[model samples]
Target: MELKKVIILGTTQFSVMMCSILESEGYSVYAYSTYKEYLNSNFFMGCPVFLTEDLVELMGGVENFMILNTIGYSKLNTIRERTFADLKMREYDIMTFISQKANIYTDKIGQGCIVMPGCFIGNNIVLGESNVIYTNTVLTHDISIGAYNFIGANVVIGGNVTMDTNNFVGMNSVIKNRVSVGSYSIIGCGSNVIASIKSYSVYTGNPAVHKKNILDINSVNI
Candidate 1:
């Protein structure tokens, strides 16, 4: 098997947790942090540590490095988006990570998928490319998730739920069993989805209802 070199952004506990997983998978890791004092600690001693401000210069000639953002909350997406653009401009392939401690039971997950710590993925789950599963999210049995889906922290997906492409599930949302969320749908935070959600709809509240159609935003019919 070919091994890949990885550059981890952020030096938080989450970053350290993911580094341990990546190391066990045989990837060479270099840790970067915005704080210089944090880099000198015993926690980061064994790994090569670089300042986040120095990423562009330090990344020179490092074509095979994959950037894994370990910052918690909404910051993960922000860093990922920025790094993705930077890496693309430099013609580098971007990579993502799933923690070893996570209970992932998916048959297949596409490239660029990020599964964070404490995630529990049940049997026969299928996730498409570039899907982000944040920390403590649980996917019950037989879930089918499509491309570019963003599943936020503490979300719970019940059995046999099918979410189509480009769906955004908010934090602490609960999707009931056998529910089908259509393409480009957005579920609001702390909502409960009990039925099938239509394409391009914005659903929220307990037993989530459509506040408005997302197609109304752009005037492009779904």
Candidate 2:
């Protein structure tokens, strides 16, 4: 299905990247920022930007409009979670984007996801909502990724791996087959995951090991 008018929910650099991809898909892209000062930006990659606070009064209706969240996964993705929840409360149809260059073998993609260019998603993969899979990543068969996960660029995941909610897997990481990463975990960049990871933890190194229990992970300086 093709969408016409789309609104993005952040003014980040990644937001500009999302805007470029959407414009390639023939979307009339608009941006809404939670920060009031950013509203003064006349253009974000050629699209008009606005403040989310002013959206309801100025725009007559949004019946035909859909919103794409551009919030990144930092500080355990609390900002992204909040933005998503607020948009859902307003009952907006959240838009998902898969690059034309992506080779998606299955149709199990969820709403509000962003799959960047050169990604190879193999068969029977159940990708959850609001997950960001960046460029050149490789996901093999039967992998299940839970919601709100940020998988960074050039990562490789083997078959039958299961990932739980709210995880930020850093760039160039490698996950072996049948491995499961629990909820609210962070996989540091370039690490190799051979075994299952527990919830509320941080793992790094060649063979990924538990560094800390991060239930309050955000408090530890990122």
Candidate 3:
């Protein structure tokens, strides 16, 4: 594989972690942040940090760069999704960051995925675009998750589950097998998903009942 230089989007803690991982793996990486302060800073963590607007000028071309949207689940999947779309529109390819420590037996990990360390992705799993499988999570076999979903750290997802687009599963949550999570749903942290969820809903608590529909809800920090 050609070693495309890594460009991490956003200046959050997640960006720091990804930059560290990519560098440790001996990849050339820079960071891009939308923060106004980062414009004058020039470099971050010994690598250059660019104003997101200047992306076209710095790289000169997209073929040599691989972009990773480390902004994470803002408004669930909104920020990450928007960043991915913006970069894609600019003809820049999104990079999938798989930790060297994770055990991925599956052949089909989608584009722009960030699979963190100590995670286990079992056989016949189909992960969709720009999903974030955080550290120490276990995705059981035959699970199919759709685009722009964020599976938090320490999550346990059982087999034969089918999730639709734009779901956010919070940390330490346990999703039982064969349950379907509908599109644009948010499963709160430390919750359990025992049954299938409806579209545009927010689920929480131990049994993880539907708290409310996302349409009625405006915005929340994940």
**Candidate 3, run of 10 with poorest lDDT:** 30-39
lDDT of each residue in 16-80, candidate 2, tens digit only: 87888877868777555554745668566566776775655546566767778889887777677
Q: Kindly list the per-residue Cα lDDT of model 1 for residues 24-129, writing each as its tens digit.
A: 7677786554445445552464666777555557777556566765543332133444544455565545576777768988758876678877899999999876
* Candidate 2: stretches off by over 4 Å: 1-3, 35-47, 53-57, 220-222
The candidate 1 region of ten consecutive residues with least summed lDDT is 72-81
TM-score of each: 0.66, 0.89, 0.90
Please give the RMSD of candidate 2 to the true structure.
2.3
Q: Model 1 off-target regions past 4 Å?
A: 1-3, 7-63, 68-91, 216-222
User: Per-residue lDDT of 16-82 in model 3, one digit per residue for the tens?
Assistant: 8888878887777755555454456777767777766667677787776778888778787877788
In every candidate, how many clashes are there? 0, 0, 0
Predicted structure 3, TM vs. truth: 0.90
The total of clashing pairs for model 2 equals: 0
CA displacement after TM-score superposition, residue 98 of candidate 2 (Å): 1.1
